[model samples]
Target: MALSPEDKEEYDEQRFAWIGADTVLATKDSDQIDKHLRIIQARVRTKSATAHRAFAISGRAGLGKSTTALTLGKKHERQRRKLLGDGPEVTPVVYAVVPPGATPKMLMRAFATWLDMQVPQRLDAPSITDQVVRVLAQQKTTLVILDEVHNLRTTRSAGAEAASQLKVFTERVDAAFVYCGIDLLTSDLFTGDIGKQVRARTKMYALEPYALGSARDREEWLELVLGMEDLLPLANHPEGSLEDEAAYLYHRTGGSIGSLRGLLGDAAIEAILTGKERVDRALMDDIILDEEAVRHAQESTAPSPTHSRAKKTG
Candidate 1:
């Protein structure tokens, strides 16, 4: 049965919203993050003043670092609201993205903006930082997730000051800090004295792309594919259809959850618009992924010396 033009428009809008609201996949990395978050929340509940330990999630782009952290932060906020009720004063989690070339003032402004506080341009960095700290403490913020923390470099004067300000916030705010960034272990954000302090205070968790080398890896990837597939709003989409093409999906996305979400989300939208109402190899082939994912896919498929040797031996 063919739909009317108005119906098609409504369906398209619905599909767009569905795709844009990316589903959170419960992969091992997210589970580990959640476990750490729970421990942090527990410490906060117990009023552990000296337990200023932070959790750091670092990896390559499109590996779901920000999503995992933000999702867990929202979950923590919800749990907090459940206990204390939803009050403006009871902000359990405060999330802010560290802007590129972030100064100490800019970093504090990010927090201030998230908290909907107006900061005067004349205020100095220390003043702004003090205000942010006071507000965060007043709001009773327990978890502070700083995304794109790779931007807070310690090499530059402004960045170093920003890093120092961040440490001060941790010390003063009495909250569990979670930092998310790309390739932070190798990044110079943690160099010299400030780096040593960050390293000592924070526990690092590396979220790597899914690998398809082992049976366990394959199972995990397939499970993620199935989970995402189940969320598609397409009427004619078959069950386990994406699971069947799980290998191809992994090849295209390099097993990055973010990349996988983008690819599937776009493909699903295309399917709805074109009246196919299903995601398949043909539909997905028409979609282009991010440069990083594309490059990773190309490298994964490219024959290597080890692969050539194994093939020859076999």
Candidate 2:
């Protein structure tokens, strides 16, 4: 059924609109996500007479670490619920972000809040810790994830204290613990006496960023870009439309998954709004040009000696 010119134009517009607001694609990071899920699932399934062992996953920002953690956590939680089959809301997987400058008391309060339990105002750290354990047990939470754990206070005595509190939490709860943060290997949470104990019990996984200099990385990155191009809404789609711009995209995004998505997302929105059938290098270049201008403006206004000296001489 060949369409008339008007019908083809309308269809292209509709396709553009559909791609404009598409959900985030995580196919590029599936391997990392799968590995993390496997570790969590194994621990969650294991029978434990006492406290379960903990695990740590570390990755830099914009690497989809949190997204991977939350996505897998929710998926397993759903599976656990399905297995129970209306017996109860067995929260087999729980995810929470660690509060900035988190103390033992603050951590407990956050945990309690996540579990829908009341935060006691007058309770000390130990008391709150007990309450959190009880609530987690009652909810049948089998895997607990504490993200951004690097933000927890971990200096001098505070570091040891926080570690001690964490040890206590893991010991008291039967659920396995998973900590997500950046640079965990170098973090204070993995040093000192208590840190040594944590290091001994936990398995560590580090997510590496895509490096443009590596042949394998370039190949993987190109695959990701092409995958995104496939999802772009367009009429009269040309094969390898975005292949040529692969290097440019990598340079612009520093080979980060999050940055690539941002570039593609903006391009898709512009394509829809302008009623264009496809995205091209020119559109993405304009976006990057505008961003560079904004960054330059910010730098120009910053307190630098050259600028300050010029103003004074003027």
Candidate 3:
């Protein structure tokens, strides 16, 4: 539906709220995260100080892997409420995103900050390890989500070193470790001997994109799709053309939840500019018109990227 004036105003406010939204939105899509979070909740209630489980949230680009991991961490925090009576308590869920070129020391610094520990700007790996261990025990962290942990494997000069460090860390740390990444992480971290050693301690998961095999579910699913018609800024298309366009949309977007919304949004803008009755195929083609269009427009828009320098970089 075309957004009414009031709708537009509401949309603007909600969009503004999401401008710097770092927390997760509770949704069925995040159930995998919830499952682990609930596990932590149960573990917390039991008072067993066993080593935490490793949570793996694997998915393709734009599939909300990091968001889901952060959501799990957030949910784990909610579950910590009843634990207030168990000595000095604090937020149980500690979330961190592992950027490329991050080492154990860097990881420690980031974790320390999240856990609210008095950590210095720089520390050796052993020292950071000591501090993190002490902090986790003290704060009673229920879960530690390390998003984009695939980058950790890329941090070391030698692949074996990276793999070994992860293994050693998991073996030594008692907190639940969550590793979120795309498909390659399993191969990168699970192939060699060290992988076999550490694989059992760590679990893996994938966040698959939304797909509709046919038009049967298209209309119903459209409401849930990320960049679909309701959110698009399209002028009214006369009569029955919108549904036809929606079908074309399914074909073009391969039913991807993220892509379909963007596809419609771009088409809507074109429709408004051209004063067209409906958002048709030709307008969709104009969005990028080719592979480079997608490469440039689609990817540069992600909320999180390993690196982004709008200006020229050497």
Clashes of each: 0, 0, 4
For 1-314, candidate 2 gives per-residue lDDT tens digits of 28797986787666656655534455455566567557755775667665556778787766656755665676668777877654555667777777777777777777888877777688988998888888778778877888988776567565456667878888777766778898887777886665677788887878776666778778888887887787776554476788988877766665566567667767876765675746888778766423533343344345676555432110
lDDT of 3 by residue, 22-107 (tens): 43433336765676656754554454444445667776665567666676666556667565544455657677766567666666
RMSD for each model, in Å, please?
Answer: 3.4, 8.1, 9.9
Q: lDDT, candidate 2, residue 72? A: 60
Alpha-carbon lDDT of model 3: 0.58
Candidate No. with top lDDT: 1
TM-score, prediction 2:
0.69
Considering every candidate listed, which one attains the maximal TM-score? Answer: 1
User: Tens digit of lDDT per residue, candidate 1, span 44-127?
Assistant: 566555637788999899888877887787778888899988978888988899999999889989999999998999998889
Ranking by lDDT: 1, 2, 3
Task: Give the deviation of candidate 1 from the true structure as CA RMSD.
Answer: 3.4
Give the range where candidate 3 is weakest over 10 consecutive residues by summed lDDT. Answer: 19-28
In angstroms, give how far residue 269 of model 1 lies from its true place. Answer: 1.8
Candidate 1 lDDT score at position 235: 85
- Candidate closer to the true structure by TM-score (higher is better), 1 or 2: 1
